[model samples]
Target: MQGRTLNFVTKSMVKTKRIPKQARAKARIAAILSATDALLRSSLPSNITTTAIAHTAKIPVGSVYQYFRDKNDILEQLYAEASKQVEELVLAEQSAVDPALGFDHINRTLLQCFWQTARSHPTFGALTRWANREHSFVEVTPGTDSSLARLIMRTFEITGINLPAARKEAVLRISVTVVSAVVDIAFEEDDADKAQTLIDELALLLSGYLA
Candidate 1:
């Protein structure tokens, strides 16, 4: 998980002019991010501009530039923050799962966690979609510690499943890829019920495979 998280952060880091040290400066940065998130909910990513973000945030354009390089820089920061939330949510769910209940229960819990995170943050789906389209943000390579794969491996550890290391790595990589693809499509669905159905089906598929 650390490797994959670092990959995103390293790629998306903003080349800011200065880091905020004072409370007021930090608050201004938060306001800028909040305004960008709000704008993303209603408008197309391409249409959003730094001046518009400043206008919405009620801060001067220079202030936006002070902490961020441009609109894309702000969007990258938003993506980085959203990704951190997702990683934390998955890790929390992994810790809460009990191997005694079996892999099916564990699998569903993690899936539900992802769904809840996406639903709670309206900006998440939009930011994810925009990032994928414009920046290839969700591309994870094999051998990297993806959150989904790490969650599965942690389950294995707790359950005493002695799978071979090489095979375990392969299985985890494929599982992460499949789940990531399904999740992307699921979030893209406009209808809430339909989106949930996709997630449920994914849970069943993973459970069967793991079992």
Candidate 2:
């Protein structure tokens, strides 16, 4: 989940520089991206024309093309932004980890961060799942995977988990897999309770595993 090899989608990479402070090209990007999300769930790419996105956005067709070269290009940016959101969540928490806390606290906080993010910007969750099926959107940075893995592995050092190197590696792998899987399932569930249930169950499961 952290270090998955999701790659680039198209040739044109959109520079988000032109985004004005008030106009918020970033928010506009999000709106257009969300429109594609509706398309991803409802129809194939071919079925979703620029007109559909324009109508969905209540803007002109040219506006869609303004930010992106084409549908595929915007899709790539959407995926990148989605991934960026998750990575940003994880990294922000990881940066401020308390030295006194055990790995268990860290894991719980990490799960909570992801859960909160999913609850807030659920479109990113849907976009992430959709990106899995279609490699049409994979604009992730190269170093992202190893960095996330190392962040998870650092918990072992803080908690004084005295295992052989092999065992620690195994634990890190499991943690990464479980963390991402739970997030994915929370999105897939779509029901509000499913996320709470998943997080609570995960809390118990990881507590035992850490013990």
Question: Which candidate number has the best TM-score?
Answer: 1
The prediction achieving the highest lDDT against the true structure is 1
After superposition, candidate 1 runs with Cα above 4 Å error: 1-17, 22-24, 137-143
lDDT of 2 by residue, 51-139 (tens): 89878877778877767777766665665666567667767877788967777787788767767765676456555565555532123
TM-score of 1: 0.81
Runs with alpha carbons beyond 4 Å of true place in candidate 2: 1-48, 54-73, 135-147
Per-candidate clashes, comma-separated = 1, 2
Cα error of candidate 2 at position 33, Å: 6.0
Q: In order, what lDDT does every prediction score? A: 0.73, 0.62
